[model samples]
Target: MNLIPAYPEIFLLIATSAILLIDMFVSDAKRNITYVLSLVALAGAAALSFYSFEAGAVTYTFNNMFVSDPMSHLLKLFTYLGTAITLVYSRQYIVSRGMANGGALGGEFYSLSLFSVLGQMVMISGTSFLSIYLGLELMSLALYALVALRRNDAVSTEAAMKYFILGALSSGFLLYGMSMLYGATGSLDVNAVAKAAVSGTIKPTVLVFGIVFVVAGLAFKLGVVPFHMWVPDVYHGAPTPVTLLLGAAPKLATFAICVRLLVEGLLPLAIDWQQMLTVLAVLSLIIGNVTAIAQSNLKRMLAYSTISHMGFVLLGLLSGVVGQSSNGAVGAYGSALFYSITYVLTTLGSFGVIILLSRSGFEADKLEDLKGLNQRSPWYAFVMLMLMFSLAGVPPMVGFYAKLTVLQAVLNAGQVWLAILAVMASLVGGFYYLRVVKLMYFDAPVDNSPIVASGDLRFTLTLNGIAMLALGIVPGGLMAACETAIGQSIGHALKNLASIAA
Candidate 1:
């Protein structure tokens, strides 16, 4: 099998091992070396991904178990960036918490993060059930370790146990579904499964059942209603940087798997899965929004908020491929992709502010922790204001555009009622986000000390905030890029499938 398409993953694997080895040897005083090396690794991987994308070719390797296309390339690059930013934002927070180096949980945070990213990359490029499951395990295992990093914290240990048990259940669901599909199709390759599905030899009852289990598994990973028991508790209990790691890039990888399994491997079952998604989406929107109003912790609030936002992503996803209209389906799926990326961007920035506000011996997790943030540091407060507004889907913010595009896709699918429901849920969700803004600007300072941060943290956060506004004002570039990427990747897969059938 040609390994050229996997250069990035291979490089990252080597670098992660090296960093882990180096971190073990370096003195605590020189721990910064590990951080720098981790960033350098991510940069190298990102550069490799960029060059792969620039080659303007779709490639499959390892017996076609892994494929590199525009979508994988784009998502992998963002995964690298998101992980790098998480490292930057968490550097101080983890260091302060003694989770960075020479501390209780220090030895593995950065290394684990890199492994998680590596798994995400594998998931993104995965073209077979085997490859996807391998990646999922790698990512999930690392996250499990990270969650329980603070061995002293009972809450953290509890959260890790819950996450691990629930995560294993989800993986079992996925595997069961995949097994059923393989039995029906006699292959694990996604395209081959699609071919078998279309040839009409597979049992209809078996196909539907397989899809049901698969959708169930995807819903859990996405942390939607019904299967989202772990999101809030885990988000609240984990260290903030670990929380960031959990909350961000992994979603993109999950979204990719959804597309791969549902859209690519099981297109014939779209009507069935789409209806299932509709139910999950509506429940997530209503429950996630309403429950978040009762939360006092900022991380838990974002956790429920995450549930609702995922519903919006599902709206875009379920809206695709009505009656085989390729162009319209591309727009619908692209909208979902766009929503996923922007949501991750906003998540990273929001968590960055939390990490920034925190100091040693203090955790800024409570809603009250943000009281009068404007008085302490107006710039970060403003940065935070933008992030909150974006999450709330306010005007001239990237989030509004993300929501609009998804709603547009929903409407295009003749699902006006679903679109209306999403809008209502968004309005309800806006309350908690606005409460955050109110807490920052209207309340008295809880602590008046200035927000001290590393130069990289301050500079990166500024650019991130600006990006929220700039991308909103000029969303065409990013939107077009997403659309093009989806079109090239999915369309190429379709063409290849047609030719194979011929």
Candidate 2:
């Protein structure tokens, strides 16, 4: 088998091992070596992904378990870029909080992050349920410890405990679902399962139950309503860098998993799943938007906001599903795909700003903490204003387009009622996002509120925040990318399933 396509992950594996060895040998005085090495490793991985993308589809090793098709390569590229940004913004935050190489933290944080990125790579390239779960576990386990890295802090410990316990429980549900799916189809490959789904030999009840459980597990990761209890506390109490990871990279992997499992593995059952997602989307929108209004902590509020965004995504996903519903056959799959892509960029920018609000012992997580931000730093206030405005679905902001695209997708599929609910919730959600802007620009600063960030941190945050505006203003490139990626997944699955059936 060809190996060129596997170069990125291969680089990541070697780098991860090297960092571990170096961290063990290096003295505390030279511990910065580990940090520097981690950055270089991530940079290398990013380069490899980009180079592979230019060369086009390349499948290498394990009979297709690790293919670097355009969709996988593109998502992997974004994942690494986001990881690099997380490390850059987090370096200073980790240092200031004494969360690097001292107390309960060290080079391990960076190392774990590398492994998590590796997991995401595996996730995107996964061709079978086995590969998907392997990636999911690797990512989740690293995240569990990362959340609790600040061992001495009670809040951190509690958050880690809750996340770990809940994460474990969710994994069980997902595994059970996979087991049922395998039993019904007698295959572990997603394409094989899709073929079986269309064959009509599998028991419908078993298939439905399995699909529900799998979706349930995914909902936990996506922070959808009913499965979102862990989000606010975990986001609030975990170290800020860890919170950034929570809000950003994982979304890509989780969405990838959902696409592979639901659309690819269970394509024939799309109608059933669509109805289920409708219920989830509406409830998540109502709860996420309403509860966010009461949150005083910025991280917690954003966590709730993320839940609402998940709802919007679910709405789009359901629309995509209903395209097959005999009612005009208008498809929203393309729209759903675009919505996930933009959501990733928008949310990452929003949280990156929060990570940079470091002032020695302060973490700037509370809404009141941002009082009169404009007076202290108009540039930051402007950046944050862009993020908040985008999230509020205001015109010309990326968040606005992200929401509009999904709503349009739903309406296209004739799910007008669901589209209307999403619109109303978007309006409700706007209140909190605008409140953040009002706090930054309209309110007076708390007596000593002077926000300061490291130079690198400030620069990256600005770039990330500015990107939202850039993408929102001219989103065609992103829109095309999303359509291509989603179509890639669908086409691949259909081709494989058709071949298997014949």
Candidate 3:
């Protein structure tokens, strides 16, 4: 089998291992080497993904257990970029908190993050249920450790325990569902399962049962309602940098898996899964948004906000196969893809600012901590304003367009009620987002300490914030990229279906 399709993953594995080994020999004063190496590894992996990407090419390897296409390439590239940005935003916070002590903890943190990124890459390229499960576990295991890295913090340890227990339960649900699918279809390959599903050989009851568990597992990963018990605690308990890592990049992987399982493997059973997603989406919107308004902790608020944003993603996904309109499928899925990317972009900046405001012996995680941020740093206040407006889907922000596209797709599929419900949910969520802006500009400073951040942190945060407005002002290029990636992925899926039929 050809190996080019797996080159990026292979390179990451080697680079991570090398960095881990090298980190052991370095002193605390020289720990910057390890951080630099980690960033370089991510950059190299991104370059490799870009180098291998083609407009419409799809490559499958390892007996078709892995597949690389435009969707995977685009997602992988962004995942790499997101991880790098996470590291950059996290460096000062990590150092200030003494978590980067150049000992086992620091080394483990960086290495584990690399492995987590590697897992995301695997999930992005996986074409078999086994590969996807393996990747998910790798990522989850690393996150569990990262959450507990500040071992002395009781809250951090407690959050890790909760996350581990819930995460393990979710994994069990996913595994059981996969086993049931295997029993019905007699195959572990996703494409094979799809063929069996469409061929009318499997029991409808068994398939629907499996789909329920599978969707539950995926929803848990996406932090949607009914399975989001861990998000607020984990975000609130974990160190701010770790929380940033947790919130940002893995989202691309979660979305990738959703596309693989729902759109790729189980398209034939879309009606059933779509119904389930509709219910989940509505609950997430209502619960996540309303609950977030009650949260005084900024991190906890964002965690709930994440659940609601994911609700919108689900809306786009469920709208894709509502009827027999092929164009509707493309528009709906493309909109979801665009929404996911923009959400991650905005989330990185939001957390980056939080990290910037944090210093030794202080955690800037409370809503009150942001009062009169404009007085502390007008530039950062402007950055926060842009991020908040974008998250609120206000005008001239990419988030507004992202929501518009998804709602339009939903309406196109004759889901007018769902679209209207989504609009109402967003309107409600806007209150909390805009509240942050008002606090920054209108209130007096709680602490007159000036915000101090590394030059790298300030530079990255500024660029990251500006990207939100820039993309919002001119979203055509990114929109076209999403459409093209989704189109190519659909074409590939169709080709696989045709081959299965033959």
Candidate 4:
């Protein structure tokens, strides 16, 4: 009955409400108070999550609907950090775009983002079907509104509608799948579902059907191929700040639910889901990388790049359960986790630079917008160069290590062909990423306007871009953390399975 497991989420919920109320009373000139308070709330939540990690082993609360463990704590901490960084980077951009003009729309942007973070925390800790669904819906609903925050823009409105419709459809698929699983296993608890899956008492055909729908729904959230129809349009249409929010931190929550659903709840069905993920992984890699080469818009290109990167994550996940033995599970899942974290880090800086370059009435979203970036500001251009290199998986950047680890894990799982295909796809994807670097370093200036960013934005982006190289050079700590988290979680799940059997 200890409440420690839910403390961070509880604190975030309260903080979000307080921020919303306080924001309502603040004047337009004092909106910075809301911004600063929101950042403090996120930092506080992160501190709580880190402190809760001292509990060590996995602990369940609310009748086992929510579980807290090292993995959840670490992911939650990063989610807080990611969201905070997004807010900081977006502050000037939001102001310049009139998104923070002391209105309902302005206030909702911050409040909804905090609520979305609350949902992400819930998703990270959720251990039951209902808990996970509630988190997913909360996050999705907030994002839908945020996408359309620019109420006067027709494109923004259209993108929001498309996202809402597709998002609702995906939710229906996920709920139906959950219902099927509940019917087949007679339990909504993830551990109970796993036990039932392993007992050979349920109908395998029905279980596989549910798994397909669940995977499809999860794939849509992750923006993989065949279900990624909303990504480019939304990224293109939303305000840059909103697009940044969409592109970065939510992926952690999505990955969290994927692990909860596929690994914790349905490990016994690994053979089936792994095969399905193989198709998804392959198609995402091929299409994401190939199509990105043709995109002139920076956001659209990054959208495709995100798809390809997620494909690599699937490769890591699918490789974990190769032949029934969970020996490779730690490495496989750890690689995916590491990849996800590094990707978010890189994305924040990438979009931060975009926001910095953008000003009133200018989007700075086109490829040509980056031309002669070096001539305007060599330091920021260097930052952009590192980000592009990292995204392209060039050597000595964190992205390279991230890709290498996943490929190594796939190879360790005897997925040599999959590994090879991943390498080829990365090579293809590198072209578009390097094109950005070339634009910044080689091409002449298009606007010749001196790049201006707030001191906070500059500081955050500089550190973020540099961290890519720093982590790449010394990736052991983060890699070890990922491995430890995954290993402990897997060990805990196995222990629960043993207890259930006894």
Candidate 5:
């Protein structure tokens, strides 16, 4: 077995364990040492991922259960960036809330966070059912703990319990679906399953039956409507940092698994799964946008906004194929990939602003809290404005380009109505997003305290907001990166997908 493909995961695991041991002797007052080490581990792993990147090439290890490819490397790089920035943004917030100190979360937040990133890395690299499931559980468990880390917070406890229960149910759905696929295909490896799915020897009916549960599981993870009951509650109830933790990095991992399972593993059933995704996309867009309009709680509104944005991602996923052809598969999937990456980047900034406003005694979670932010600090307010514009899919921001590409992909795939519907949904969604901007620029100041954030947080938040506009103006590079990554993986799979479409 070529262990070379697994180096990043292995290094992360070892580094995380060492951080745990080293932190045991360090006092909470000196916890910055642990924080520094955690960031170093993430940076090291990111470097390794970048070094190993190979366009249009794939490598496998651990008896082919772990695969390293361009897409994995790219997503892993973004994952590292997202996780590190999340820590930087939330560092003071965590300390102020006592999650970094003695009686509550202790130093485990750092270790648990690293471990969760490791799990996400594993998930991004997973090439088989067992590996994917193992990775999912690891990440889910770490996040569950992180959610309840504030031991005395009744809301955190409730949120953690709900997340755990829903998470467990989703896992069960995934495992059952995998078992069904295994029973039909007589294999656990994704490649083997792909082969079996297209072979005339296996029963297509059985595969479709299994795909239902699989899509259900995937839908739950993506936080689309119907399966999205847990999202707003959890996002509102969990500590803001944990909310960012749950929101950002894990999305790339989930997108990876969705592609790995549905596109790579079961391209033969594209038509069936695409239909499922279509219904999910429509419902998510309608419900997520409409409900978000009613929320005064900023976190919950963002949570619903997450659902609608995910619907656009589903649009790209489902647009990969038209009947009897793999036409537009690369562009469609690439658009979805690009959208996911940019969405996370935008989300990190938006939530970072929320965290920046939160003091030891203040949560800064209500919509009114953002009132007259521009009057307080024009720079921070400007950053928040860019992030809101991005989320609202306004032009000159990355979110606009992301949506445009996905809509183009959908149109190319012959879903003209879907594309139109997506545009309308975005228009409706823009109201709440722009409402925030209104509060920041026009509303009276509710509190006049000076905005204070660590230098690192401010630096990253500034860069993050700038990246949104930068990518929108010249989205070619990231767009091409996503296209190339998806094209490399889809090159062979499209041949099979063609047959399924036919």
Candidate 6:
């Protein structure tokens, strides 16, 4: 087995353990050590993942259970970068709230985040359902504890409970789906399953049933409606930094899993799955957009917005299956991948601002908190405006392109009705997003509300906000890179599946 491809994960594992040990011995005054260590580890991981690209074509090791392909590697690169950014954005928030002070403070959160990153790394590269499941559990288990970190808060406790219970139920759905697919095909490998399904040898009823269960599990993680009950409460209750992490990294990993399972493994059954996901997608669009208009809490509103975005992403996935064009699959997959990256970055930027606005004894989650934001801090207000516009899918912003790419891909797939529905929902969703922009610029401040953030927080918060503009304006380079990654993965997956089938 070639061990070089695994270097990124190995480095993180060792570094995470070291951080944990340091936490046990480090004092509150010296807790900053954990942050420094985490940055080192994350930087190392990022470098390693980048290095793999130059080595040659993507390859799977360990009997093809895990593959280090361009797509997975690219996502991991963003995952590490996003993780590092979150750490930087989180330091002041964590320290101020004593999230870095107590016995479990400083190092513990960083360590768990590193562990979660490791799981995400594994998840993106997984070539088998078994591997993905293990990675999912590792990531989910750490997150459960992270949500409940503020033990004294009843809301935190309840959020943790809801997350844990719902997460377990979803995991069960995923596992059962894997079992049914495995039983029908007698293979645990995704490529093998795809080949089997495509061969038309399996019972139709069993295949459809398994696909439904699997998509349900994926929908839960992606925060789509019907499976999205946990998102708002969790976002509202968890530490703001945790909300940042939750909104950003794991969603990327889940998107990878969805692409791998649906586009790669179930390509042969595309016709059936596409109809099912279309319904789910439309439902998410309607529910997420309509409900968000009524939310007073920023977190809850963003949570619903996430659900709507998931719907858009599903449109891209469904398009890949239905399109007649040869490049349709590649376009859909690339669009979805790019959408996820932008989504994570924008979420980080938005949450970073929330983190800065937040202080001890202030939740900073209500829309009223954003009133008169421009007058208090023009720079922060400007940043928030950019993110809100991006989320609203306005032009020249990354979010617009993200939605456009998917819609284009969906149209290429001939799913014009689904594409139209998405556009309508985007218009409706645009209303709520614009409301935030209006509050920041037009509304008078409620008495006693002011915007304040620490130095490091401010610096990163600005950069995160500007990134949406930068990428949106110069999206060609990133879009090209995304296209290349998805193309390579799909080509290899098809070749491998064909070889196995013959």
Task: Assess each prediction's global lDDT (C-alpha) against the native.
Answer: 0.90, 0.82, 0.90, 0.90, 0.92, 0.86
Per-residue alpha-carbon lDDT of model 6 for 367-454, expressed as tens digits?
9999988888888889999999999999888999999999999878877887888999999999999999999899997744565666
- Least accurate stretch of 10 residues (summed lDDT) in model 2? 322-331
RMSD of each: 1.9, 2.5, 1.8, 1.8, 1.3, 2.0
Scored by lDDT, model 1 comes in at 0.90
* Model 3: ten consecutive residues of lowest lDDT: 492-501
Model 3, 5-92: lDDT tens per residue? 8999999999999999998898887888888999999988988899877545888999989998899999998899889999898887
Model 3 regions more than 4 Å off: 100-105, 492-502
What TM-score do all the candidates reach, one by one? 0.97, 0.94, 0.97, 0.98, 0.98, 0.96
Return whichever of 2 and 3 wins on lDDT: 3
Model 4 off-target regions past 4 Å? 100-105, 494-502
**Model 1, total clashes:** 0
- Put down candidate 1 lDDT per residue, 360-456, tens digits, no spaces: 8888889999999998899999999999999999999999999999999999998999999999999999999999999999999979887888899
The regions of model 1 sitting more than 4 angstroms off are: 104-107, 492-502
The runs of at least 3 residues in candidate 5 whose Cα sits more than 4 Å from the true structure, single-residue gaps closed, are 54-56, 103-105, 498-502
- Candidate 6's C-alpha runs over 4 A off are 103-105, 323-326, 447-451, 493-502
270-365: candidate 4 lDDT, tens digit per residue:
889999999999999999999999999999999999999999999989988765677788898999999999999998899898899999889899
Candidate 5 achieves a global lDDT of: 0.92
> Over all chains combined, what TM-score does candidate 6 have?
0.96
- Residue-level lDDT of model 5, residues 124-149, one tens digit each, is 99999999999999999999999998
**Deviation in angstroms for 172 in model 5?**
0.5
Number of the top TM-score candidate: 5
Q: Model 2, 384-414: lDDT tens per residue? A: 9988888888989887887887888787777
Give the higher-TM-score candidate: 2 or 3: 3
**Model 2 spans with C-alpha error above 4 angstroms:** 58-61, 103-105, 323-331, 447-449, 494-502
Q: What is the lDDT, from 0 to 100, of the residue 162 in candidate 1? A: 91
